[model samples]
Target: MPTRPNYNQSSANHPIINTNNNNNLNQISIMNTNVDITSYVGKVLNINQHQVIVEDVLGQGGFAFVFLVRSSNQQRYALKRMYVNNERDLT
Candidate 1:
């Protein structure tokens, strides 16, 4: 059997309560630790004055890499990192 990376499971302590409102905040993100966030593992990313701890990598594409990040408030979000910045887009 392959060894698994140890991740903090504190996020699993909270109980999930789904409300009538359609919001992602009500969902629970039970990370499949089997898949690791290779490059960004154990790293905190600060972008646009916002800081988040990368938990698991959601997915990756040609131009950008999506990460499953957790905020200080215990909220989770899909942080999309756009790598291909063209001169026109930056301008």
Candidate 2:
């Protein structure tokens, strides 16, 4: 079997509110919110004075990549990118 790259050491921590099961599960939230905005082709993202460029990367054990962008006009924001198998799916 082929080994996959390790991407699980990059996130923060947060408390989750689970109301489904009687058991309360405490999970650690990753803080690896780096995103490569350049990869978002054709996608229009609002850019402001507070906006920052970030690199998209997967946090250790993270299922997805998130972007941490700050807007001068507004507060900080997190931009998430969905991984697609093909470019055509982007549409």
Query: What is the C-alpha local distance difference test score of candidate 1?
Result: 0.50
lDDT of 2 by residue, 1-91 (tens): 9553443232333222222221211111223447533344223343321233332233323444444433444344454534444445445
Task: Name the weakest run of 10 consecutive residues (lDDT summed) in model 1.
Answer: 17-26
TM-score of decoy 1: 0.53
Clashes of each: 0, 18
Per-prediction TM-score, please? 0.53, 0.29
Off by over 4 Å in 2: 1-52, 55-63, 87-91
Per-residue C-alpha lDDT of model 1 across residues 9-82, encoded as one tens digit per residue:
32323222222222332132223433434657557765544567777655565655555677778787766554
